[model samples]
Target: MENSAGIVKPQYVTFRDDFSFESGRVISSVTCCYETYGKLSEDKSNAVLVCHALTGSAHAAGFHRADEQKPGWWDSMIGPGKTFDTNKYFVICSNFLGSCFGTTGPSSVDPSTGKRYGIRFPVASVKDMVKLQKRLIDHLGIEKLLAVAGGSMGGMQVLEWGATYPDMMKTLIPIATTHAITPMAIAFNSIARFSITKDPRWNKGDYYEGEFPVDGLAIARMAGHITYLSDPAFNDKFGRRYSAFEGFYDFNGFFEVENYLRYNGYKFTEVFDANTYLYVLKAMDIFDLSYGRGSLSDAVELIKADTLLISVSSDFLFPPYLTEEIYDIMKYQGKKAFWYNIQSNYGHDAFLLEFEELDRLIREFFADRGL
Candidate 1:
């Protein structure tokens, strides 16, 4: 499949009769589309899975072979000699099950009825997404991985992997994320969901073939974008800069910051589907590492591998407090774990922005393992 950008769509396999979720619905099948970089070593232990963020796709660190215009989101950190050096590790990045980019989601046609699932797609959780990932790894014949690393929503998945399959990874990195959704995070996500559901065009989420809820989705993105940056950072970026237009006679605000946010919202709509965004955000809100276990320490004991917990000092969404809690628990449980709280004004998005230090840290970590 070719996207509008002319990128050659990734090849994928649909696993029928995969595992069911705690919600009691057996997802009849799961289709996972992924992109691979570097060559798999003979032992297959060099594999590293890079899970994408909430609105991201399987494309992680390079431009598609078919299109050079759009490079992967983490292009800065994954290269020949970068943090996740493709030169030494076979990297796999997959579009999560509930994503819109070539993977089955609300926009996908329901195989049973030959129509889109839309709102009817089974409610997916972080666990369900992790299960689909397991199938994808099994299909790729990778029995073990060097690491499973990601940030934000991706970080949530990394934690889930450690909980769900503790023995599969040699190292784990979950950055700028939480062990579970906090009340404050839930409040933000709830408002975002409300924006989408309140749109007239949402049509009970059956808007696949009709006009989309662009305005609502745009508003949602705009709202979430606020959490991605700190107030000081935003002030430095825009402050009181006026909009480019001369005299503001229009209803749109005259502040340059307003214009920037509007641009972000509009651009997001063009590349993302509204329904998928809702589903993924909902999944993130529902993720809680402390769900089944009585204590967070008990949960950390379940992880049977060396873990590196990375957090940003200024992040408010998944605050450093959560990462600190996980770190403390891992130590209490006698797990080999290291913690790093990067100092930056970038806030929650620091993990994606602060690369210089990240590069140094990752290099040292991998070298210590003789990679």
Candidate 2:
């Protein structure tokens, strides 16, 4: 059914054939959950794929119902007359292969064992996610995409799309993402993994039948939430503020930021699975465009699509320099590329928060492309 905005609700497609993984494991079946906006043009040339970041779902815009409380994550930059202009482009967003939001993941049942895959779920890479998306796009009968865009982990998938299926898309936009996972990112992921594993209830990622490792998962989400914000952003938003109900010397209720983190953490555990978090973060930790390529330039030179790289000045996690590095490589190789550094205090999440700037850049880019 269509919402009040005339956009269809999220849909699901199950690929029942055995799917091979990069790790050499094969899954008997796979399912992809997705949402689409707009109609395919008569020439089938107006398709756009919006990849979601870590923990994001396929609901990229519009509400499922008239009274829904919130729209999709990138609602501000999509829909009629927006950055992606759903009125003109057929937009698709799918839950990643290793995600738990109605996609095949650790929580999926293993056909061989007839039980939840749990820790047995084959580990996936950014490339794996794109491959599955390619399948989904093909299933939708689109042979090529007009543009592919995303940020953070989603951006990683965008780059993978350019490299793995260089001829599949016309334009690519990667925001706040690096060609490779940095050491600092690995460190943060390690701590998050440790937090989950150390929780006694984790039981080696097999807690589906019993109590979940909610405490550890919450802590992990809290740690990740910090990296998404800049120090200045934190200072501006919280900055030594104390909770209103704090008593004399309470350890847990010391700072307002702590309370905010705790609240978010608790909320996360309610919707997310701990095993899926571990698997997806592990994938992020090992992402590298140059993994088997001779060099960074070699890998980037494989991109056939025109590229746009967007970075945030305050994004310490995937700093602006990282995006600049990719741009430098592409420029040296004489590839068509553009770079924009958004001046914002939102840090890694600036791509999501700086909607006005992003909207302007995207609109201008598409205009220049005559789309």
Candidate 3:
């Protein structure tokens, strides 16, 4: 099945090995789902890894099937003549290790018990996810990636790629992400997790065989959606608009923003898994570039790739200050680093929404490098 852009369908690779988790647990086998665009060069030197954000899938560009309703998440920036131009680069995007999108996650079956892994799935870290992707790259016969780029949690993976396999990628682009998750970010994630666990349907993440925790998961998604947009953006877009329902003055159906959240929450529950959400959030919360290294500076000093850090000015969640900190450290360590702060009202999601600015920056950046 091909999309209008003629991008190929996603493919799967099952890695049979004792996959080790950062938390000292292991999974006997793992499967990675991925989609590739364009052709890999003869020397395998033209490959780019496009990492997806939280709730995103490996279908980064083009339609999944002829009748598909929506195009891939980053379709705007990743097709013929687009920013990442599939015509010139072999772009690969893979679902994260613990994502629900055809990857080995909590929803997958546990080979040992013949049941869904659920809460029993070992905790994973950003490093673990990068390690899995590294193996996938090797499986595809790519010696090194030309570039690795992403925003949000996907950006965390990009950073991990640079840190874990410093020589694996030639360039790194971490957008709207931090080297270490801030306390404020952790607090928000904690609230989301608590909301999920407190729901009766959660049943300690073992709700796979019964009614799923849709309510809790929806609520969590609602909370996260709010963080993705800035107050200014929200006001401009939603403001004090009232719902269209008759006598919509009640607490449940009054504000248009409230209804919008509810709609997104409902939509998320249909596509996302509760247990996978919990596990992935935990991974983001505990991520620290300096976990094993002595300090943030020390950790970044190990990066051999040229780095580009992009931050949204209105992003309160991952904040511009955090990305600035990373830039400072990289410059201090004499590493090749560049920083660009996008003046946008869309907050943390600006990287995904502000296509014109993003495309311009990316185009110029690559052109300067003769890509």
Write one digit per residue (lDDT tens) for candidate 3, span 1-371.
22234646989999998999988898899999999988888999999998988788899888877778888888888877888887789999999898899889988999999998998998878888888899899999999898999999999999989988998998999999998888988888888899899999999988887998999999999999989999999999899898868666655556889889999998999989999999899999889999989888888888999988999999999999999999998898888899999999999989889999889988888888888
| Ten-residue stretch with the least lDDT total in model 1 | 1-10
Better of 1 and 2 by lDDT: 2
Q: If ranked by lDDT, best first, what sequence of candidates would result?
A: 2, 3, 1
How would you encode candidate 2's per-residue C-alpha lDDT over 1-371 as one tens digit per residue? 23222445879999989899888888878999999888889978899999999899998888887677878889887788778887799999999999999999999887788888999898998888998999999998888899999999999999999998999999999999998878998889888899999999999988988999999999999999999999999999999988868664865556889889999998999999999999989889888988777788888989999898999999999999999999999999898899999999999989888999999998888889887
Query: Which candidate ranks first by lDDT, i.e. highest?
Result: 2
lDDT of 1 at 335: 84
The C-alpha TM-scores of every prediction are 0.94, 0.97, 0.97
lDDT of 3 at 112: 93
TM-score of 3: 0.97
What lDDT would candidate 1 get against the real structure?
A: 0.84
* Alpha-carbon RMSD, candidate 1: 3.2
lDDT of 3 at 284: 94
Candidate 2 least-lDDT 10 residues: 1-10
